[model samples]
Target: MKFEILQFPLAKSAYGGIILPMEEENKSEIFQSPTQYESRLSRPKNQFAPKKIFIILFSIVIVGLIIFGTTRFFAGGKSEQNSEPAPTAEAFPTDIPEPTEEISPTQEPKKPTPTKIPTPKPTVNPVDKTTGLDRSNLSIHVLNGSGAGRASKKASDFLESLGYNVIQIGNAENFNYEKTTIQIKSAKEEFLSLLKKDLSSNYSLGTTSADLASDSRPDTIVIVGKE
Candidate 1:
């Protein structure tokens, strides 16, 4: 194998030259100083190191933000669950009502009415129309057959009060006669019947006898007798 040398110019003014083989020229270009070698190696690493540190810090910040957001969401839900409404108070009455009194109704009393009284009626005496003799126009003779004192006089006065004309007043001939006898000289039986109402219950009618004289005989002779 043949070796060859190559010359290289140092400078334009210096005509000296140094020769080196091709392999030696290549070894010089490839070798470096330690400080320069360290500086060259670290410069490439420092340039990419800034990008890796920035990427790692960015990832950590994103994870911290996600954890903080998740924790805040759960805490807000728990706060909402614990909240509740407060109880209301009851109201009481302040004033009480008063009692009232009862009253009764008033009434008035009623008065009684006056009663009516009836008046008495007057009594009337009977009259006869067949004979023209009434109580006002009849002729009468009062006789006392009884032994009672003043009987003829009392009878005469009583007959006069009844509007009768008493012509005679005397005692009977026989006091032993029990019933009174009315001797009628005239044929007027109605006058004798009318006069019997005023006489006693023991009286009877009889015809006038011929023994009685005509002048002494009345129309009706009343003979008093004991009853």
Candidate 2:
């Protein structure tokens, strides 16, 4: 620190035309007070601090508002979806009428029942050609001409055992035959051979006649005599 002294006319006029030298710092002190200078220097710093604080508060408010708006928007959309109605099943009708069948006006007449013509049942004659010469179809009448008791009956039983249909057994008109005689109806003449075959083992065969009428009920007549 050095000091330099200078004098101005205003100082000279005040000091009676004598010039004086003064330091630059002392001149500056003479123009401004220390309190005013100190206050002026701190003013920019105070204003800058308040501006930064204001900016931070404004950013925080803006972020909070944006977050609130976004949250509200999503919440409102979810509420709308939840509030919509769900679909339901349809109900069945209960009072439907039953269908009816219709009858026609012009029905056809019923056909008359066909008359059952009684077909003549086939007559199953015992001596038909179909039943040719079996013993069961040969009706026999035995007569004992041997004057022996039960001779005709024994002949009749023997013929029946051979499957001949023996219709009667009795004594003949006369006991004069000495051997067996066979008489057969012409309608049953086909059975003569079979009867001879059956009686040949038991009695000697005598005269044989095939002249009996066709209407005779017995197909054969036999007269038994002494063996």
Candidate 3:
């Protein structure tokens, strides 16, 4: 009693054979969807992940900077912010003006006393016309202040270096600076000229050009000359 499946031959069969019916065969099941298609349609998304990570990193950096700044600000030992002083317009002044101060009485200013210049006694001699030979205050007579002519400049330089004031007087080139000689025509003529000059300035220069060369003075004559 062995049972086996039999199949029946159709057209072109050499002989008829036994065949199994469709209802007698068993069937296997299959999935409703394709695995590859399902997997592709349900794939995971990654687009916003990097953006989220960057946002998080940026937020962390900002927080870190803020924390670092705050920590340094306190540890650096800086003074606390101070409240502003009250404005003068808002605060009452400690010093107040009185009614008398506002209405100060008007008064006249006193006149300055006149200063009296001392009256000089009349002197026979007059003031001499003088000029400073150099930058020094020492003055000399004549249109040209030096008697040594241009040579007087050297004498002036020597006198200035010696800290002495020197002024030379002459109508013409009368003194030879190299020789230190007065080429005067006469002692009398020189004396008279000096006398007249001394009388004019209340200053006496000399009797002769030689007399004025050195610091010398005629005691009787108010005008004196430096020999």
Q: Which stretches of candidate 3 lie over 4 Å from their true place?
A: 1-30, 35-47, 78-227
lDDT per residue, candidate 3, 1-227, as tens digits? 99998756433212353333333233112212356558867999766678899999999999999999999898665444344454675666587666663433685556899999998644322223352122233333322222433433443343334333345533433231222222122322333443343234422233334334333321111112222
Better of 2 and 3 by TM-score: 2
Query: In terms of TM-score, which candidate is strongest?
Result: 2
TM-score versus the correct structure, for each prediction = 0.35, 0.42, 0.19
Error of 2 at 122 (Å): 31
User: Which sequence of candidate numbers ranks them by TM-score, best first?
Assistant: 2, 1, 3
After superposition, the stretches of candidate 1 with alpha carbons farther than 4 Å from their true spots are 1-132, 201-214
lDDT of 2 by residue, 1-227 (tens): 99989746445433255435577678665545667778878886435577899999999999999999999999999999999989999999899789976656686656899999998645333332543656787889999999998999999878777677899999999989999999999887888887887799999999998997778778899999898
RMSD of 1: 32.1
Q: Which order, best to worst by lDDT?
A: 2, 1, 3
For candidate 2, the TM-score is 0.42
